[model samples]
Target chain A: MSEATEQNGKHFPEKQLWGREGFRDDPYIEAESLEVAGDAPAVILPLAAWLGLDDDVRRTSNRRIGVFVAPGESIDPLLDKLDTVPLIALQFPAFNDGRSYSKAEILKGRHGFKGELRAVGDVLVDQVVFMLRAGFDTLEVTNPVALKRLSASDLRDTPGYYQPGRGSAKTAGGFSWRRTPAA
Target chain B: MYRYDEFDHAFVAARVEQFKDQVERRLSGELTEDQFKPLRLMNGVYLQLHAYMLRVAVPYGTLSGRQMRKLGHIARTYDRGYGHFTTRQNIQYNWPALADIPKILDELAEVEMHAMQTSGNCIRNVTADHFSGVAADEVADPRPFAEILRQWSSLHPEFSYLPRKFKIAVTGAEHDRAAIQTHDIGLHLKKNEAGELGFAVYVGGGQGRTPMVAKKIRDFLPAEDLLSYTTAIVRVYNLHGRRDNKYKARIKILVHETGVEELTRQIEAEWQALKESDLKLPQGDIDAIMTYFRPPVLPERPEGWGALAAAKKADAGFAAWVDQNVTPHKNPDYGVVTISLKPIGGIPGDASAEQMELVADIAEKYSQDEIRVSHEQNLVLPHVALADLHAVYELLLADGLATANAGLITDIIACPGLDYCALANARSIPVAQRISERFGAAERQAEIGELKIKISGCINACGHHHVGHIGILGVEKKGEELYQITLGGSADEITTVGEITGRGFSSEEVVDAIEKIVDTYLGLRTSKEENFLAAYRRVGAAPFKEALYGPVSRAA
Candidate 1:
């Protein structure tokens, strides 16, 4: 892997995901002053006290956290998070996956999220163009594969297809028909 | 039949323009491949084994002849001159290029259609009974609610990025024709004693690796709270669904891990919070949507409808086709004709360009210009005149679409398996064909009686195998195809997850095992008329298991 992942210690390999539930009582994870995106349970401050975040406000910092983009994932949550982060990396569970692509596009084009939009996981050389089109300026190519040697130009290839679908279907098969002005 | 309102029209236009800009940006190398993948998928586009598959939602399986013709135009002009109707009641054009999708979407939009959310983890195309409006057993048409769900879910700000793909299906009949129990969220419409409409909501049902029948979260929910209650369920799932492991990300997993009772409590809490919000469905809004879906002006009972007896006597082929394809209509003079998209020896859900045009013409002529795609890999002309059944039958016969096997063993439901699907472990079509050929005999299918055979290439259960009376799941073992057979699952109100009896079957022996099970049911059934599902339920899987694993020698 690149210098980014010199060793798997004290850090996630590519991205750190903070779902509703996360690693608790783990030495690697700090238990204090964590900020949740869009959703939080009742009594977070109290939980902080319960977990002893009361003594340490700095524990939540330095623990790099990120947002998620899934198939039919709402774009607004990620958009709201973009305003505060310098780099927002998207994870594609599978290579042929499409949901995260929409998130990247909305983040860049619509929400104006130009700060490092990274593509992580199942990131293949061939799919580089799709990743580029979806507005992921940075790519965390899995395992520092052969594609790591690609120049900036190579990763930024033109993605074919002209349809507008990002942030469109909020759900699966949740499509709408668009009428174009006749030529 | 639900026409697009201005809001819907405006939303699609904005989305189209947005995609156009994205495509332009991609072509200019302004973005990288990593950035563009999800954008394409949200547009109902996918890069598959052969070509880019563009899946267009046929909302609730309802389509007008005009829309069908528009689909045909796109197929003939942009694609390989045909589209495959998916099990979710959506039509997929398998050969569209990535470059042409926007233009295609534009064309679709002109016809009040778009390919949004045809893929991805979002709430997918809401599916309903193909015979929704015209079914004799229906108390209410599920299309309006499906449309409402479509609107509420479309580009919904809070739910675009979910843990995984979410699917919902609706059925309004006492007889569950829409396979509602097998969806991530399923709803059944029933009337209360006070003549008020309500829904019976089922949650957490899914057909992936862990095939499950959704538990009833609420037996009867008031109609006004449908949207709000559903929003509560999805929100609860979004907040609590597991994201650490992809396999366990589905709401089914959440419901399973949390226990349905507590999940129900959480949903109740969420609903209680949103009980009085704008999310609460208003009577006027429901009426407005429902108004667009009322029955067509049908003719009075015709003499030829009763004269069908004479016609059957005169034409045996017509009789067979009628017996298989025609369903009793609420209007006694009419019938809903299920056009079998599962033509024998053909792909289970595909339609040729010619078939589309022909169906379009047939729809305009005899079926009130209405067409529906059933989740079971078939099409329905929801308003066919009973007197014109012969005419429809003749045209269908010429096109090789006259398969008289709806709900019979030969009418197998199959997913696009290893041949095209990237996720499939083995091929599912050939198995479906083998079974179809084995049960192709009219006499054999007639003897077997009302068997639902659903096959999935993998555990995703895209074929709804879990709820099938006989579910065949294809998996790879030692680099060879091994089929696992599960028996006695029902997708109806009494939904039961099928149980695997024993060892997996080879591709060659899979159909034979199905054969053995059917034979046992036939032998043990009290009446020749007792269908496979009824017999399996009455006698349980012991008899079928014995028939499949080979009879345990009685030690005589």
Candidate 2:
């Protein structure tokens, strides 16, 4: 039995780890999955493998692919394949390395990537706040405390943000627009 | 002195609660030391050699009378009844239990202060010109922008986990008292030919094992682009800065390796993309922040020169104090009074609870309730009236706060070297104290004339030895403490790194070596008017080398 995590109000089994694995055997998305892998469905590929895939194969692939990006790793080669891929799982390697945050921002804000942006590896309770603001809606955290914190409804209770984002106040990346009295 | 609104209040209160939880988890052994180290550092809790030292941010070095009083309270109630003012313009309580940090942070939050971002890999405290609002030669007050940065960088979600620590400094004066050139990002607030406000953006200047002066990336960046431009620069650094080696991970190394032009091009591209984003500060927001930092308006008062002159004549001690401790304010009737924390044979920058309260009381009574902590490890009452100087001095003297050595040779800047730091190779305070006592006489200091001696325990340069007029760096040699001296460094507008003398001296020999170097300067100087830095610059290092190591040939 597989466990499911919440995403956009839907539960999806997180069977896709960042490696050269065979696609998930799903009945509903066979046509989409078979485009590139010819019958294997929902395959997850590491950055190198994804880059090695032929351009024509990647362009013709109707299946939603997943690619993992490490901290300080350039994602320029993957930009052209972003439209075909449905998930971009950026790796944190270490919680201290923050390159993933900028990677997410470039994917979402600059490249207009509408796919699911996920943060993987060393996802702790503290970094979830930053990850969400940087446009990572899906998280793969192994820490039990962090997972519990993520599911709690009060996770967003911290007051006014300084970064302006996709939504208005009270949403991710929103800032308080309060004005002060005259000095 | 930006007062907290509902948002600021809620933000800090929530942060306190979150930290309380973190502390609980750490104490419960749920989080390992490695897991908790970064979190503790981000909150300015350091596990030093002896105990956990909590550093509290004093934003832009400005504090209210009430805030200063609260600091005194924390010192008396929690740690030892004293606090050390750091060169970063913050305060460190040398002794605090890990369990008490959350409570200390809670106490700090009541006064709109916290230790958040004081350490760790995030943007640290945004330091500015200590004489900001009342400076005689300022284009604009830099505190407002500093406050803006403080808010934006506080708990900034994205840039929190940088490859290395980031520091930003701002200056509004041409004198560069804030030492902007040695920071990761230096902003010079200025007016263009049209008299419109803007910033001259400097990037990648820093001091540590490797010291580099910041380069001017943009000669004139519009005031409105402050946030966007800063964000762009950090983002570029975040994506590309080296992470393989901790020592070379600083943005300066990145700037050096990538070349400034390429870095600037990347930053410009990032800024262009962010210009239309919400990171751009609207005019109203700038005005709102700026209003909080406007100097209090004062009516013209009598010059009171005759009364001051009479007081000076009556007491020679008061006259010396006035001559060294008082600075001219932009307003003719007002004065900026520097309360020296470096007293004879005393630990530099450590003020007892009583001393803190006494200064707070003086600020409330005579300086419009405003106080500043300079990067030189001293406090300032920036708006004291010239007529009230005598009264302020009397109170300071009583509380042991009046040392009358603001910029003199005895006013040494020393880090809490091996005494408290985990990284220090040798002790700095004892050396600083010995030098202070050696040159403690008011007459001797007056003769030396504006010499700065800064000491760092190690090459991390926390003591700012790189820019000190006379810099001393302590190193461990053969498992013993060794001191290396450098000469002619200045953090002023003309920034220069110091040059190391031939050999390192033992701890016992360091003080005598310093005396010989000063004697060389005194002998070579043409007149009393030529200070140590000037004479050293003119004569170069030859005379000082000969004096310290016998002869130029033997010196090498």
Candidate 3:
């Protein structure tokens, strides 16, 4: 059982976070097993291990299965099997490293991945709105202050958007100026 | 001019409020300096050696007379009475307290100007040809596209925190006054064989420690495909650009290390997937945006030429100013007037509040309420009638704004070096000031013709020394400031990076060395009309090197 904590004056229950028992400390390491039971808790596996799991192991698993994808790694081979995974955590190694943004967009907009797309690692307050726009449903923010700032409804009250984007609700995106005949 | 709509106004206002809150949080110790640095930088605040420097974006270098007055107001009230216009067509206030920045930004927001993305890793203020709507050679106005790109790139969620900064430039003319080749992504608006407007896209060009001119990736991308294509390119770069080494993080390095052919393939593959999305510019939307930039109404004056000619014959000083500073406009009656910010022995791009106010008044009276800031660190009144040339010149003369050397030797481009910037290795302003003084003689400058001398304090190349016809780089050698001279760089249609000519000189001797090189160029030039750059291009660095460092020995 997991406990909840208060950040930025808002309380959030901890979601089931799972990884390989032996290699959990090494954030970048691959898992060796997919041995969870049919009703096991959520599990996070490296892309290679998720792809290597036996069909029975993946199909019979009742828990949510997630995979960690890094920058420069291709997900073309995993597209066809996207239905099997419930979560795809795109890792941002650092706050300024933005490769995973494009990765998330491609996963959502191009491949039509319908699972819980979470941004993991180095997530901050300023980037949350962009993360939401880029199709991230959950953000595992590592910064406590960033988590606090997220509770302020900062993402909802953003004034307007200039670009046409998917996944997030934006106030304006089209050329309504000229269409209204300059009243 | 594109006026800010309600959405645009609301967006900037919200951004101002957001930054204000961030500053307050930093002051209250809720955020550390490391956390606050990027936040402040995204709003165009830099903590320089002296104090906080705020850079305000003059989008596409186009501003209204009222905007100019507001800039002057900011300089006078918030800053130290003067502002420095930069190489990217932005204006920087050098001395502002951190506490006063929020108020300064609020002041800027009132004028529909903000400092967003002016200093961050995101797509920077999109620059275009300064003579965009007025140039006689332009096929289409590039400002509309630049504006669209500006809106799209602003607070771009994904690309905001790229490995390094990115810059994009657009040109609508064949002559390329925008120096598109030196930008990270260069867009040249042109017409295809079917007489449809589009862009010739160039990618990977930049100047820092390792300078590379952009290479053409698409010869003719349809106008509607601009956003899709640009997004695809940035996405590919974002995913694949080097992150381990900050130096090799630019798209130029990516294009250089991973061969252009492979990079092109990757970008094309991404674009293929994104082309039909909402990112694609609909034809009607393009037309709508174009409507905003339609030329302002100004009647043609047939007698404008005769009036200008008569005025020229009456005054030689005004005649010299007219001959050097005025450029032909698409409307025959009007002319583009460049107000040189580089006064003799003065700072390169600094203008006092009084000077800015006077310029604004002049622009309002004669130039149809429009002004443009050039990347050359000069200001342009882009739509002055030929009949008002003398009147404008007289007004400029009164305020010490009328410098006859527009593209000539005295009009140098220099960045604020050790005096202001924290990253500078040596001073650059003093070196530029000395060079300007050496070439200050009007007749001598006129004889020398069109020559550009650019100086930089460090390898960051803020002054664009890498592309100057005569480039001067300041390096610190054993605690002494030495100037290294590079010969034969040009940022015109045919772009070339300059090559260094032997060892550097002491700050005391560098001016003398430059004079000797100029003397050599004057002596060896084929004709008086053949400028220093033309002569250097024809004869190469050998003669210039020999003139500076004596004859090289073959007995090595």
Compared with the true structure, all predictions reach lDDT values of: 0.74, 0.84, 0.85
Greater DockQ among 1 and 2 belongs to: 2
- Worst 10-residue stretch by lDDT in candidate 3 chain A? A18-27
Clashing pairs in 3: A8-A148
Regions of model 1 farther than 4 Å from truth: A1-183, B26-32, B551-556
Candidate whose TM-score is highest? 3
DockQ of all predictions against the true structure, Cα-based = 0.05, 0.48, 0.45
The reply for model 2, stretches above 4 Å from the true place, is A1-40, A153-157, A166-169, A172-183, B552-554
For model 2, name the residue pairs that clash: none
Predicted structure 1: lDDT: 0.74
Give the chain B TM-score for each candidate.
Answer: 0.96, 0.98, 0.99
Tell me model 2's lDDT, rounded to 2 decimals: 0.84
Residue B38's lDDT in candidate 2 = 94
TM-score of 1: 0.78
| Residue B9, model 2, lDDT | 81
Looking at candidate 1 chain B, the ten consecutive residues that score lowest on lDDT are B547-556
Q: What is the lDDT of residue B197 in candidate 2?
A: 90
lDDT of 2 by residue, B485-513 (tens): 99999988788899988889999999999
TM-scores of the candidates in the order shown: 0.78, 0.94, 0.94
Per-residue alpha-carbon lDDT of model 3 for B406-470, expressed as tens digits? 99998999989998999998899999999999989999999888999999999989988999999
Give the 10-residue window scoring lowest on summed lDDT in candidate 3 chain B. Answer: B547-556
